[model samples]
Target chain A: MLERGEVANSWRHERWDSFRLLTPNWQSRLPGHRYEGPDPDGYMTMAEVTAFIEGFAARSGAPVRTGADVTSVRRAGDGYQVTTGGGEFRCRSVVIASGACNVPVVPPFAGAVPGSVEQLTPFDYRGPAQLPDGGVLVVGASATGVQLAAELRRSGRPVTLSVGEHVRLPRTYRGRDVLWWMDASGVWDQRFDEIDDLTRARRLPSPQLIGTDERTTLDLNALTSMGVEPVGRLAAVRDGRALFSGGLRNVFSLADLKMERLLDTFDAWAREHGRDGEVGPPERFAPTRAPERARLQLDLRGGEIRTIVWATGFRPDYGWLDVPVVDEKGRLRHEGGVVDSPGLYALGLPVLRRRRSTFIHGIESDAREVIDHLATVTLAQRPGA
Target chain B: MTTVANGVNVQALLDAREALKGAPEAAQFVWRASSKWQDGVHSTTRVKEFFGLGQEQEHKSEAVFDADHPEVFAAQDNGITPIEYLLIGLASCLTAGVASVAQNRGIQLRSVEAALEGKHDIRGILGVDSDVRNGFNDIKVTFTIDADASRQDIEALVAQSQKRSAVFDALTNPTDVTVEVA
Candidate 1:
């Protein structure tokens, strides 16, 4: 395996200071390296995650070359040539596992913001201390955005969180982690092809969840109660002023309604399996609350907000791949991870093969499937025995 | 399963969606209306033709509608006001979506009724209150649906309808509008 840096470089460098695995430690399963640490129910900090991955590398005894930045991958006769910073190697089959989040996606309107306001994506954010001393505007209400907004507010910084469509999920439900119910109910194992709307499902933002000792739910209501002002999606930036949508109420309603449906599914599953007696009674959370009139505009020149952190999500960087597998939108054109090219494959994409494909516990199955396909193709191409 | 439910042609809807995926540009539509002033807060708008499926198409018949404020606004009581037309559009779109989604889900509907209330201060347009909005402060729609499904299922149907309604999206999200004069 070739790595641009040491093993678990992203975990060590990209994540915020307070970052923790969204999944419980118990779910951190690889092919042969199941998490054997104590506190299986607790979340692992970034440092622990890095250590775990490095340990896995050591124990697996896999041949890995660190500091090998791949420059390009192209066809070379019946094989493939991978040119890296270190050297070039030829292989019959190649698996691109660079991961989905390689580049931060900032909107074009971000350029209109006054040069006075500092801008940063989640990729560059470390902690509140790194930000300038003033109010903050965190765009996007995904997991990263909400977490940062809450942390910044608690640190005595006024925060205005601009929310779009977001998935609201509780940390725990009915005396178990929400992830537990999804896993036990077979929701996470749903195949990509089995979904009704594969396009919508794949594009869904990450849920608003936090991994802490308290295991508290961090939703819009929670943010509001924390003194963090909630606003609509950032619509435009004109004349040093930011315009927000007037759809905050509907956005909150949609998220709450979706959460209710998910909980209903869990409840029905529990009843069908006769497991209701074992778990706590089904409970519902308070509906999200919105401002009577959400503010529609904010002047960047007014010195109210010092920094703007964009948690708008990420996209893969495939600039070095000398292939035609990318689409007009820069998305990989693949059926579940099988590229159209005979020997090329992709991994670690959202719902690439299954709903759980992006999770650590899920990669084992995907990796196994890809390796199996590679073996079959290599065997078919071999000379007769 | 039968392709017909609640009088909706489910197979045709699905086929159209599939076919459009291959020719996305054909799905772009331009609906239009031409209005003529009829004096004193009144006007008549006619709808006849639209562009869709990569060509111009016409309605079965040209439909004319009139708009005017009520007598309280010191104008002759003509037809319903223009704001009322917005409510009509939203209601029609959501109702259609509910029926189509119900048909797709194989839920037989007995009856579906909707009541919509649009609360407008009107002071913004009158220039009496600058803080108030000219449009409705908020609109609420309640659906009383009797179907062969449970209460949660019915609620899910309505929610799904709103999720897919184009008018609802346009109302909730911002859209770029340009006005040009020749």
Candidate 2:
């Protein structure tokens, strides 16, 4: 396997802070034996996680060519030409595990926010200590946005959060974890085809939940009450002034409605299955108030506003692949990770097959399917078959 | 050549800008409104709005704003409350700013959504606490703009609009007010 960075799971390299997996421990996600380590509540730091993967790789004796950044992959005679930073390797088939979070989607405003005001994406962010001393504007209030904003606020810096439309779910609803409830509710088992709006479903932002010391939920309301300035959606920036939208009320309303519906669904399911004890009582709904400023323009030039961290999420970049399999929107069009371009395949894409397809626990099924397809195709093309 | 896209007339805007540049006095405008107290917490403000300065034709329109409360305060359940009117005024002004900016920039916007929320502590208004302010402690304006342009582009447009907006300026900065028997 050709690895792009020096280490496995290169995305986690820049992340200096400690975090636990959204789901359970390594043992549950990765197939096979047991993880005979400090399995304290399943949550672990990046260091511990990387060590586990390295140990797995060592045990399996997998020939991983690290630092091999694949520049392009083109079709050869009967195989494929995999060009990389180091050199080239001709292979029969390619399993593209580049993962979705390959490129950070920084909005255009980052460029205009004055050279003095530092702009950092989640990919570039290390920790709070690395930032300049001043108020920070954390845009795109999803998983990274809320977490980073909280972390920074804890670090003794004022944080202004630019909220977005996101799915809000409590980490622990009843006695059990929300993930457990979702699994029991057959949410993960839901297939891509079963979804009414595939595009919308596929593009759904991850639920606004945090799994740090424990599974905790964070939303605009929580953040605002916690002293974090929950502003409207970031609209524009001109002449060192950051402009926020006037539709914050609607944003809060939508998020609140989603949360209500989600909890209601879970409640109904619990009642039907006689798991009422497992489901907790209803949460009091308090919508976030939109600021009075119809258009909020914060002066970034004054130096009070130092850093602008964009946690707007990421989109996969498949530009390196020299194949005609990419769609107009720059996404790989595939049927369960198996593309129409014979030997080429894409794995670890969200909504590839099931809901958990792109997740750590879900990638295995996608990989298996791709491997099976590759094997079948290879066998059919064999000389004496 | 100036381009026109969203609801903005670029040529007309350019002409206005040129007109303002040639004669700065013509750019000045004044808006007037008269209000009468009905009862407790109830007042009616009559607005015969007119567009002044540099225009060949005098434009006029009539509008009314009635402020009242439900059971909370001692007033008949009438039109939207005064604070609500303030929010509406701010919302409408900003929304106009967004539309103007989008149009001026030639952004083919799919939809423009704007909302305003104000946080208030009634202690100051009721004279329960001397420290508490009489108005909204903080107000938040949120917008969800679906446009062909990038998020940054739209944001920049909004910022420019805020800097240029009359209502935005009036609220953020204090304005001199004079009261006398008329």
Candidate 3:
């Protein structure tokens, strides 16, 4: 297999200093390598995660070239031609598993922020110590954004977190990890084809969750209680000032409502399986507290915020892909990992094969399915077997 | 025969959506309204022509409405105020969405009513407080829906309606408005 740098390079480089797997250690399973660590319920730190993946690669004994950077992949004859910095290889099938988070997507108004304020995406962010000594504005309230905001606030950096539409999920629910419930309740195994609105499901942002020893829930409300100022989505930047949306209350309401619905689903599942007696009673969280009048704008030139960390989102970079399967928005047009073009496939994308496809434990089933389809195609293409 | 459910023309709506998918440019609609000053704090707005389907079209009939502030504002009590019109727009948009979504989901609706209240602190508009905003502080929409389905299903309909409502999105999200004096 091709390796850009090494096994689990993103886990090594992209994650922050204290980053940990959002899922529990027990969910860290591959085809054969199941996590048998002592802390099954605990989260794996960045170092442990890299070591785990590197161990998998070693045990699997897959021939991997570490530094072979792929330059282009295009159709050649009946097969495909993959050209890399080191060499070129021809194969009948190819699985593009480079992953979805290839490049950071900052808004156009990001350029309008005064040059005096340092701008960085989560890729460049390591920790609060790497930032200048002042308040920080962390845009986007997904897992990465909320984690950074909380971390920075704890480090004594005044933080203002700009929140957009985000899924609000508790780290644990009713004496069990939320991911465990999702797994046991068959929610995570929901196939992509079974969903009505796959487009919307795929476009959804990551939930506002964090992994810690205590399994704490890090939502906007939690962030607010931690003294991190909660603001609406960043709308614009004009004349050295950053403008935020005025729909903070509605945004919070939407997230809370959705979270309630999910928890209700979990409760129903528990009752149906007669497991309610085993777990804690169903509980509800307080509604997200929104300020009556959230500040609409912040003066960037006033020297209050010295750094702006954009945890907005990421998009795939397929500039090296010479296939026409990419849509106008650069998203790969695929149906359950089966690309529109023959002899091509994808892996490690949100909702690619199932709802759990983006999780580390989700890869085995997706790989099996893709390989099954490949076997069928290869057999059909063979001469008169 | 046209497929009608919950008083919504389901077939036509589906057909239009399907047809527009093939010709996306035709789906770009430019809604228009022109208001003329009638008197102090009053105006008459007319809605007739709009651009859609790659051409300008009429609404079959011209609709005119008068807007004015209440007597508390020391203005002539002509008709509903402009802010009230925004409430009307939001309510109607969501109500229409509820009917359409319910029809699509095959849910028979008995009654669907939406009560909307927009709380606005006039201090900002009156130039008394710069910290206050000129728009409503918050808009609350309560849907009292009686349907053949369960309560959960009814709530889902309203939530889905809000998710798909154009006015709801425009109100909750940022929209760029460029006004120029020519």
Candidate with maximal DockQ: 1
Ranking by TM-score: 1, 3, 2
- As for candidate 1, its clashing pairs are none
Whichever of 1 and 3 has more TM-score, that candidate is: 1
In candidate 2, what are the lDDT values of residues B119-178, reduced to their tens digit? 889899889999787987677788888888876567655655665667765565444578
Q: Is candidate 2 or candidate 3 better by lDDT?
A: 3
lDDT of 2 by residue, A47-73 (tens): 766776777677778789988989999
Question: Could you give candidate 1's per-residue lDDT for residues B1-182 as a string of tens digits?
Answer: 36436887878989999999888899999999999999999999999999999999999999999999999999897999999999999999999988989999988899999999999999999999898889887788999999888886787788778778899877766677899996
Q: lDDT for model 1, on a 0 to 1 scale? A: 0.90
List TM-score (chain A only) for every prediction: 0.98, 0.91, 0.98
Report how far residue A262 has shifted in candidate 2, in Å.
1.9
The candidate 2 chain A region of ten consecutive residues with least summed lDDT is A26-35
User: Which structure is stronger by DockQ: 1 or 2?
Assistant: 1
Better of 2 and 3 by DockQ: 3
Model 1 chain A worst lDDT run, 10 consecutive residues: A376-385
Q: Against the correct fold, how does model 2 do in TM-score?
A: 0.67
> Individual DockQ of the candidates?
0.42, 0.03, 0.36
DockQ ranking, high to low: 1, 3, 2
TM-score of 1: 0.94
Task: Give per-residue CA lDDT, model 1, range A1-385, as digits (tens).
Answer: 9999999988998899999999988999887897898798999999999988998899899888999999999988766899999999998778898988999999999999999999999989999999999999999999999999999999899999999989999999999999999889989999988999998888889999999989999998899999999998998898899888776776787788889989999999999999999899999999899888788889999999999999999999999889788887888888878887878898899998899999988888888887787778754675571
Candidate 1 chain B least-lDDT 10 residues: B1-10
TM-score of chain B of each: 0.97, 0.88, 0.95
